[model samples]
Target: MQSDSKILAKINQTVDRLSDPESYDLVCHEHRLGEPLPSTEKLAKIVNMIREILFPGYFGTTSLRPNTIKHYMGVYVDELFELLSEQIMAGLCFTCKNPHEVDMQERNRHAQMLASEFIAYLPEIRRKLVADVDTAFVGDPAAQSQSEVIFCYPAIRAISNYRIANQLLKLEVPLIPRIISEMAHSETGIDIHPKAEIGESFTIDHGTGVVIGSTCIIGNNVKLYQGVTLGAKSFPLDEDGNPIKGVPRHPIVEDGVIIYAQATILGRVTVGANSVVGGNVWVTNNVPPNSKIVQFKARETSFSDGAGI
Candidate 1:
């Protein structure tokens, strides 16, 4: 008991020191105010709850009937709206930071409105996501059905999270979009920044190690294979050699572009429409429309037909 009390005392002292303005002045200047929310697990559950509601029988309790499903969804939607409203309000308050002005009521109203708007978009999102499911099905042979993809595929999981996060981002709610994507990242090993403009009919095949960075503008019907990275080859660095923040650093893949496995197309370069970028290729320059890039003379062999020493 004595040791526990001493440990608690030490933790309190450390927290107090951290809370001191002077002690944290330099760091605080670099970072700003953002009140922490519930854990990512909690957020993930909320997201999954939303998914279960949106796509009935695909996620969460599978035993629900079509009749009872709406009732369950209404309950989940209410709970999600409540929790998301609180989190969004916290985000707004954190970002407002005026200190002299804190309008919690107005922020709450806006948050509620945003939540309502996001809920309204669910049907359209589902419609677009159906196209994604079709793309995935036609793109990959292993997928049994749309139901299988919805229930088991990481690509679907990641895409679902991205769509949800993208809607929140469009609503201009800060921090939550990134958190939602990072949750999908943790689950699926695919890192798609919420700010990346991805179009409908997008599919990620065998999605592990696929990274779509911020500023990546993906057009419709874009398909990416595993280990493909649409990232910047080089960042515009500051005087201190740190990469400049918020620059357009990723590729803009035009519509109908197929990026195969392990292909790294970097920078603000535009991959023109109907292009096929093959595996293990590093592309920095702009690819012309309908261009096919593949490995050349990369394989080595020794002839065994000749009678040699």
Candidate 2:
């Protein structure tokens, strides 16, 4: 071990290096003294609360009888306002370049108002989730019941989180929505961007390695199997040679389309309505409506070994 004097000197030097503006400026998020940053832990709890409120009967241990449901909903909504408002305000602060310049009281009021608006959207979210659950139940032969789809399916979990995060993104609340989607991505291997516009009755079977890009627009009654990637082929660069943001890049899956397992569709191409895209095919063009796309059949080969080699 080193002497105490050397240890003290090393500690002081490290502290000085960390505190230096040049050394820490690029990596550190310089937050204001009183402004709170978004917490993944709190957001996780908020998601659980939303799940409890959305599907009261299935998720937790609580009973949702006729007499107790109103009481539970009332209590959950009241508590959600407090927690969600804090997170929204934190998102606002995180996105702001000058947090100290913002009027915290006014921002708090705005956050609360937005939180209430989001609470009102719960019914609509539930309606969408119901359609998704039904689709998953019917699409997969292994799914025994709607309850099984709701509770055990990773697609439901991922889609539910995506819908919630998409609403927040529409409300123009930053940072928190992406964080929420990332929570789902971590729990299930389905990576859906918060900004992606996905329509009703969507189902993903065996949802692993699915990447739905930022600018993707998926229509109603669309189904995607495992390892399906809806991504950007390439990005248009700016004057600085950096990729431009918010350009339409990913494929649009029109209504009634079924993209099978391991299908990779790229660019702003539209996969037309009622089409069937087969497994493991790479597509970068617009597919006509009611069309079927599949990979070419492999040639049959025979091996001659019978101990005569």
Candidate 3:
């Protein structure tokens, strides 16, 4: 009875509060929404599945017959188009202030067209990505096969996805490019901005902690080691002391340059062709062609010998 009385008292108090004049005006609007959009992991998995089907045995599951491959790809492409279109519309709506006036049909149509174009570009993307794999294989002696590079190399995965998404970004299809690049970043720990311009024949060895910032222009035959960061030093600030956006941040690495492990090359400085940046060096100034930079008083040591005495 005491428990019942306590419950009744609480209910009566709530009713009384709702009936109050101030509380009545305060009760404005509320509605329960559905589950949020699909996660980046799931989206990435879908993309991976599509890539696998498109370039069979390259990524994801490899079990399939010759006849079934076409059917499976068709199904996945259909589903991807649907899911991508929905997510794109959601992104478009999120960015728009006047959401109701935004046309879902137009957005969906544009997304579908871009998605098709992206699908068509896959063959060319694969052709270019094969060169990246070749570069990695030829550059790294430990790399066994093209398959190994495709499966185990983080740089290939990150760069391949970036190039694929960059084409779409260049087409100006909105938020999908950033989403795709972030998906790669989460998986590989290699954060390459989609806007960064990278040339052909680029290879990254043991690519962890690799960050290539936006506005970076990397040329052909460039090789990067793990933990190498091509970044900007500082941005020019506005009158309010806020950092300005879209300035020429990050370095311009010319063709045939090699940057060793843990090197941080910053600013709009250019590293000319055939230049070699040694490990653990912080470079802010421009480097002329054929320049080799190594740390002062550094001695060569083997991996088994343990670093420094």
Candidate 4:
């Protein structure tokens, strides 16, 4: 055992080494003096508030009545605006290359404007969410009702998060959208990138392990199952050997396509409209419209007595 003085000295030395700027300069985040950082807790609250506003009587503490619905909406919208504006400001500051040169007051006003615009888009978001809930209810035979789907389905939660994040991404609010999407990904095992272009009435059954990559265009009425991977096959490298960014590298699924569980569709291939991709298949090429792709049958084996000779 070491002496008390020696132990304290060793601990101090370790702390000093760890705190050295050279140790973490590459990955360290050094923000402007007064600029705020995005808070996951606040973003989570924002998501909950959106859900409550979108599906009244389904989330939050308020017992909503027909006459008071507008009042509740007003309150929720007001709160959401403030929270969103703060987070958006934080996101703007987080991405600023020259924080010293930028006007903080102007940025704050811009954030407030973006928040107001997002609030105005709430009705549209609610419309899409209602469609999604209806689709889930109609598509799943086991679903008792649309209410049940909204109350219980992980797919609903994931898709709702994606929809909200997608809208934010469209508004070009950086960092925050990705954070919102990732919050859902952590809770539900579905990973839909905010940049992914997914149309209305999209459903993911048993959504765990589903991965929809950025640049993937999924058409309306498309369905996916568990363990499905709509991912990139290979990266197109630059002259300096870095993988090129923003290239279309993931598969595009056209309208009315159904991809079964564990199917892996890679590269920039197009799965045409009304196609059905069967379970556990590996697809790297284009699938024609109305085509059905499935794995070949396994070979049969005969045993001599209890074991093969």
Candidate 5:
């Protein structure tokens, strides 16, 4: 055991190191007085509340039936509005250059308006989620029912979160949308950027190690397998050598396209409608519509063929 004096000295030194201005200058979050930063934990609860609202019996409180559903929805909607408004305001204040320069009341009203707009879109969001659930059921032979897809599928969990976060991003709510998507990403091992625009009737099979980049526009009825990467080919450097931001870096996957496991489709290319890209293929160019791309046959090797080269 260390001596008490040694422990105090060590703690003091650690605190001094942590508090050094140079150490924290770039990464520390700065907020104004009386302004609340977005809370990841609270945002997580909000995501859960959304799932509960959308799925009803499958997600939370299965005791609810047809007769009592309306009352439960009303209560959940009220609670969601309150929670979402606060978090949205927190996100706005967090991203503000100087919170004091803005009028607090108008900002609060704006947050309320955005929150109401999001609430209005919830039914549509739920409708799309039903399509996703049905897709998952049809895509996976192991799925016993649509209820099984909702109850047992991690893809549904991740995709539902992406949809919610995408709508939040569309609403111009800032940091909170990324955080909400990341909450699902951490749990599901599916890294879908909240800014990615994925359409209806999408499903992923065994959805581990899937990465969808921001600016990716996925069309309807698309299915992707595990270990797929829809990523940028390379960054276009600016005059200062920093990569230019928001220049449409990812792929535009058209309707009914299927990218298989470990396939790498990069850049702002288009995987044309109804196309299928085979597993382990590296695609960096546009694929024509209705094409099926697969790997070439492996050549047989012999000692006389100089295969070592």
Candidate 6:
């Protein structure tokens, strides 16, 4: 019912308001003019390539034989190196506060070096992931084989992402590690922070709604079930009322511990080695080694004779 010219003018006014720099300055990321941003699609491809390399015939190539495995590994490694280096460079550029001050050539060389170092570390990652898969297969009676665990379990997928992202975090290549971890979170409903220090032989069963926070130090051979949250109980706020960053706030889970479904462990508490935390329990204090923490049983009430009391 409005005039075409008037509607166009109104739309132009809204566009002008949205284009105002003042409106989005706080949230906007202003990067170098020609620098590339990190791409989630490319990172997803990188993850898939890493999986294919790690699991061989289990992932990408069905026709892979022992004789030709080396050839496939070579091809995957080359492609992964190219993709990873570019993403690392993009991450570096994305986090640079003053991009003009950075030497682009040196940054590219550094990214390439990091990618090569990561490639060399692939064997170590594979070793840890093998342990994880074995643990998952052994722990779950429903799992027929380690290969089945590798192919069917969401925990393996989530843990693989965490391992890769944690290695990248160790290399101090910003942005990409968190992105990689979040990709797994989106797919598996399991959120393991890249900064969390998780040891080998870890397994999560029925892994939905699991949240492992940054600064959580999980020991070797630990297992967690669904709906488990290892999170901070409270944040230490600064004068500006913002939570302080880089503080060790999450729980430290020791070796051989099993946290059952829906357990919430918060703050900087320690769950000692070989402990079993029962389901739906809220733990905030330090638990001793070889302890079992469970909820108190519900009471049964006796009723008087009907309408006679």
Q: TM-score: which candidate is best? A: 4
Candidate 2 runs further than 4 Å off: 302-309
Cα deviation at 154, candidate 4, in Å, is 0.4
What's the TM-score of each model vs. the native?
0.85, 0.94, 0.80, 0.97, 0.96, 0.95
Q: Candidate 1 regions off by >4 Å?
A: 1-38, 62-64, 237-244, 299-309
Candidate 3 ranges with C-alpha deviation above 4 Å? 1-38, 63-69, 299-309
lDDT of 5: 0.93
Report the lDDT of model 2 for residue 302: 66
Instruction: Encode model 4's per-residue lDDT on 1-309: one tens digit a residue.
Output: 999999999999999998999999998888668999999999999999999998888888877798998898888899899999999999999999888799889999999999998888988988888888888889999999998999899999999999999999889999999999999999999999999999889899989999999999999999999999999999999999999999999999999999999999999999999999999999999999999999998979898887975
Please give the range of 10 consecutive residues that has the lowest summed lDDT in model 5.
Answer: 300-309
lDDT of 4: 0.94
Q: Highest lDDT: which candidate? A: 6
Instruction: State the C-alpha lDDT per candidate.
Output: 0.85, 0.93, 0.80, 0.94, 0.93, 0.95
TM for candidate 4 is 0.97
Sequence-dependent TM-score of model 1: 0.85
RMSD of 3: 7.1
Q: Model 2 compared with the native: what TM-score?
A: 0.94
Worst 10 residues of 2 by lDDT: 300-309
Weakest lDDT window of 10 consecutive positions for candidate 4: 55-64
**lDDT (Cα, tens digit) per residue for candidate 5, span 48-163:** 98999999888777445899889999998899899899999999998898766899999999999999999999999999999999999988889899998998888999999999
lDDT of 3 at 215: 94
lDDT at position 70, candidate 3: 81
